[model samples]
Target chain A: MALAEPKTTSQTLWIERVPPIWWALMLFLLTMPAWANDFFLFQVMGWTFILGMIALSLMFLAGYGGMVSLIQMSVAAMAGYMVAIFGASGMGDISMGLPWWLNIPIAIIIAAIFGTLVGALAVRTEGIYTIMITLAIAAAFFYFTRQNYTIFNGYSGFNLVVPPSLFGVDWRQPMPFYYLTLGCAAICYAAVIYVSRAPFGLTLQGVRDNPRRMAALGFNVTAHRIAAYTFASVIAAIGGILLVWQNAQIAPGTAGIPAVIDILVIAVVGGITRPIGPFIGALIYVLLRTFSPDVLLAFGLSGERFKLLIGLGFLAIVFFSPDGVLGLWERWRTRRSRERDPLTGEQK
Target chain B: MTLVNTTTAADRLGSVSSGNALELRSVTKMFGALAAIRDITLTVRSGERRAVLGSNGAGKTTLFNCVTGDFLPTGGTIRLFGEDVTRFPAYERIRRGLRRTYQISLLFNGLTVADNVYLACRGVSRGRFSFIRPRENDALLTRSDELIEAVHLTPWRDTDVSNLSYGQQRQLEIALALAGAPRLILFDEPAAGLSPTERAELVSILNGLPGHIGYIIIEHDMDVALRVAESVTMMHNGTVFKEGTPEEIENDQEVQELYLGDGHE
Candidate 1:
């Protein structure tokens, strides 16, 4: 037997653990809230990071498992709703008033189980069929939450689902909340990077590339796909919990059809091929969404024209770089490396 | 589907008292109104190399699919090492140590050569689906690297599989089948679409295969099929037409008329 070479390329290694660029970016993000304005800190970067986690979850499915799940936003929304319905909230009459310790894990577990079920239904299909199955599930969940009052509180969802007021600190405060979102985002990011190199993730990719071959190689393709959903759903659930905390509320609109597609847009725009593509794509989306309204108003256009701006931007990116922002980055890097190394050769 | 709770089967399974490694009885596959394979029965002892030869659409590939669990046979029984695996799923059949390669290379295009081989090796081992632990940490990683070297793919081990040449991909395909150290491996046209040099290399690879592992080489190349296999089973229109040693198969006049018709050499 030939001894095994390292399976991981440095490009995919847990996000270049000791890379100088990564360290520099980490330092900048860690210190942003210390000097930035409250709106800039929370509404801008904070929301970006939180939504980035949901996109990252989608990336895990699309990038590694070759699965596209439109129900990811709903999975997060479900976790968010669980936080309000199970724990203390402004809708105290509807809230069960359970302790945070019990409610949080229950929310994540329920979300994960729900995700796995969605995957089980969709895993047997591939490509467009998989997309349609997930989209249907997202649509069904949204309508169910919107119309069902007893369990989901109908259209006007439970509000004031605040972060845990633990350790003598108000977590919703700008500094505390920024740290919370940052920490969670970093953890999720690190996890996406790590798991992509992990055995389960590799097997999942193999299944994606060639399910027939993987089965012949003694792998349970369906099981791997379902397991992928469970893992991603839990991550999305965590993001949902953070999202609910960010907005301090949940509503039908949170898991609406458009929101379901937004996560897909974010994931693909980031280049679903790379682990960090979702975050990069998320940053561009949030910036366009947050700043374009003001830019539109300056041009005698209504603030609602941000959607037009976002649509135009999305089309431009997709047209030029179909693989999304990461594909563009990869092209530039390859060109630059060719100039520098001379003989390392361009990546095939 | 191995019954860990049942002590009786395990006790009987240890001694290989019977010589037959495979026994297919009256196997038939029907695609709606058409029968793809009709009443195919064949037996091969452990460590025996058999080749199935025929022109295209002769049900050779279909037979391979049925045995590998890609499609459940419309009728019949397939016993792998004395155990009935007719109803087992493809992955289950693989775990029972039945492996196969596709007519076209079915490799992981998104991963490196090393990663692809590691997946095959890791699949046969315990916890092939360990979520938390990276496969790099698996002891089989070393074996995967070794297999890559054995197939002369170490130089391209880190390269994405899609970048490799067709011949190299074929080598990796064989290496993947070998990585599991399977009890019986089914190769679907192992030398298909190869250059003369590549064909020579493939013949050497097949000829040098260890005797402990049994193989069923599906080949269009007469020289390759005859050289690598101890016996030949000729197929025609979804059924076994003839079975004999290499010399016996080469001289059969009826076999020539049916198999090597007007167009195909």
Candidate 2:
């Protein structure tokens, strides 16, 4: 029998310790202020957290599972519409009147089902075909929602939504709401990290690299890809729930083409290779979308130019760093380290 | 425990005395009127080292593909341990202890060589869906280490597969096939791009493996084939033209004319 090779010191160390810098960063974020007002807590931070979570779901499929999907936000919108229709406000509300717990799980499950169907079909093809199929599916769902008022309430949409409440505390309250969003985002982020390092994650990567070889090694490549999509949908669906509660409304606009594109932009801007890439991108996006109009007004620019500025930012980031903000940050750190220590200056 | 885990290395090797690890009975596959491999009936007995020799379009690779479930044969049956597995999917056949190494190294380039072997041993220790971390499988880690050591690649085990030399990469590929402890290993041109010395080393290693690990090596290198394989099957076009000991094949006038063409040089 061949003997086991001894692991190197670096591998051994990485296996043993979780780096201290990450912990320090987490503590710093935890101590930051809840926010000075609802605008910061609920509107800006809340949207960022939810959009970031949605983008993170795409990251799981694209980066880890080697699947590109344009329907993640569309799936989220399905959950949003489902919640509105099923919650105490819309069509199902009057006809069925189900409790909050039952409604939310059903919304997520339905969104997951929608996501699984999309995944099963998209996974049949690869590369550009996968992208096209997902885009088509998202577009079809958007049109269906826009035209059907009885179910999705048509283009007029649905309103007067409420998040589940516990102990008489409105979880949707600005501060409480921000915490809830953060908590969910944190869990999703942690789960992505854990899964990426797990055996299944490595095997998924292996499948992406060489599906035939992986198949011969006993991996059901299609099954893994679909499972990955399903996992991504679960997170996106939760983001959708939080999003509807935040706006107290659900609309066809939420599931439209532009919203679907925005999720992709967020993933690209954050560096789709890493899970936290979405969060970084989400912060930049939410800040821009929230303040773009005000910033344009200050510059004597009209509302029409707000989108132009956002577009320019996207172009600038992509042009300067194809991997997005995370890529730029990595490059900057490597350059700084090289300047400080010329002996060992290579970047991974 | 052995019966429950029929795919395990010990279980597969234990059943070697029962018969050939793999049997192909009149297997044929066609793609649009072009017969890739036709009416190929072959048996690779347990503990046997068989070499399938042919030139470029002799369907050597095609036969390996059919055996490994890369493609289902259009006709006839394939048996693993006296049981028909003609319609099994690639993963299912692999689970039944049948594995193959590709002509081009199909290793995970981004990961370490050890990680490549670790993946092959992954399904062995636990189910394919095991959530256990790579570090948690000490038995697998030990097995992978043994494979790396057996291939004399302990020094480069931790290095990325991309960083290895061509010969080392080929060796690592074989190591990966061995990692799963398969009952039958199909090598598709194992010595394809290796140096003469490297080819010699591969033959030695192939010869050294225990009797339980049956192999069907597809090769163009006659020297390597003669050294390692216990039996030889020569193919012309897509069908086997002759089968016997290497000496018998070397002396056969028909094999020389059809497969070798003109001279034995």
Candidate 3:
């Protein structure tokens, strides 16, 4: 049944496929340390990257797999706890004092296993049930870590849990730490984007859209979903390690219910539709969190009302742009394009 | 009259050796007290084209669903290619060379036509969990492209499935079913909601399929069904009323009285 005209398009070079705007953005991020202050570099951007990575994991599950797992924050906390327990920490009785290379991989593996187990349990149900199951699991982890004194150090966790010195550089230093978190976030972002078009990612999307259809096409829907959790957990695990290093501590509150919900808010606000959405959401969240207290005080409100402010902002975003900031941006772009004539490039 | 009650071991052996593509014995599906289909038995040989025809509520779709493992039969066994797959999951049955298209278009609407075909091809093959994007020259990619062409959807390859017309979507449905080395495919109302021109195109596509790939089509369109199918199975109230050659079923007095009526279309 060969057709006379085979309409296969010629493949373009990989580098040429990337738009010019991404190059400009990469350059700006890479050179930020040159002009930005130490506090901005170490605290604001560093926190943004860490949160972004964790939220990216959530976005991957929610956007592609149709599984809005609240367990990602807990998974990150698990990694953070793993690092503190496996590697050096102020709590010598709790810490194992393993080497960085060993402990880091161990921590990620443990968290991934935890995520896979959660996935296994969560995927047995569908839709709103998935959210509830994951939330329950996350809450359980938070409580377990708080109560388990021997393993988790109880409510008060390990402090001085810094990153290992590598390449003659103190990784805890602001500049180095920024680059570290940035590098990790970049890798996670790129990996998510690359994998989205791959068979695994595409099939996950298919599973999300029509699970029965995917199964009929010979795909094990449950397995693909569980595998998605494993992939997402690794990224969240990296973010957790980086987060613990940034704060120099890990507490039960680090992965508390509030923190877990905050990640959901961040992912939703930034837009869960694309990989870049989580980062944008994270950046907005970090900026608002960092400056909103002062802004609230300036407006004659208590600085402690930051959560209220965040809640209001979240409500506003949800009310206006249901798909988050990315959806708003897309709408704007489409409208702009529609205004211009394709043949002459003149505004209609 | 080869109605030998095959044992599980013998069934497994005979499935492959006996040339039977599908075997369903006393298959039943119940939604609470209402039995959608009950005690339905069916058999189709390898490389045989068959049409399952019934009036609305006759449980033709339910029968397809039972065979495809979308709905586990309430009681009884379904053997695919000789293996007892009664309790097997849909994906397991699919991997065993069974594929099905939904009565309604159940496609990845957000994805492109090429992506949809590619996913279907990748489903039954190895490396389904691959994290690498298929290269231009990848075997599955080439196969997907060929299937798209076979369905005459080459021009709309890059278009999103949601953007495709009703006829085009129906065509894409057939393309998806044809992916991989499917031995037995279940097409549920594939000719439904298609234009007359599209129906002819679909008939041609069905007739042009490789000889060895057998299919059981559920069609309301008599002309299209009678044209593509060599044999016919007429169902009445979730049970097989008659099974005979297309000509025999077409001229049958009971079928005409029950289904076609006096002025048969």
**Top model number, lDDT:** 3
- Which candidate, 1 or 2, has the higher lDDT? 1
What is the per-residue lDDT of model 3 for residues A203-269, given as tens digits with 9 covering 90 to 100?
9999999998999898898899999999999999999999999999999999999999999999999
Let me know the TM-score candidate 3 reaches against the reference structure.
0.95
Where does candidate 3 stray beyond 4 Å? Answer: A1-10, B1-15, B262-265
DockQ for candidate 1, please give it.
Answer: 0.50
Clashing pairs in 2: A2-B146, A3-B145, A3-B146, A4-B145, A4-B146, A5-B145, A149-A154
DockQ (0 to 1) for model 3: 0.48
- Per-prediction TM-score, chain A only? 0.94, 0.90, 0.97
TM-score of chain B of each: 0.91, 0.91, 0.92
Candidate 2 ranges with C-alpha deviation above 4 Å: A1-21, A34-37, A90-97, A334-348, B1-18, B124-126, B132-138, B257-265
Chain B only: TM-score of model 3 = 0.92
Could you give the interface RMSD of candidate 3 in angstroms? Answer: 5.6
Superposed model 1: Cα runs more than 4 Å off: A1-17, A337-348, B1-18, B133-137, B195-197, B260-265
Per-residue lDDT over A1-348 for candidate 2, one digit per residue giving the tens place of the 0 to 100 score: 011234444356553556888888667556544435777888888899899999999998888777889999998998887788777664553324568898899999999999999999999999899889999999999899889866777887887777878988899888888888989999989887766656777777788788898887767788888888888999999999999999888889898899999999999988898898999999998888888999899888896677787788999999999999999999998787877746655443
Please give each candidate's TM-score: 0.91, 0.90, 0.95
Tens digits of lDDT, candidate 2, B47-83:
6889999888889898988888899999989988776
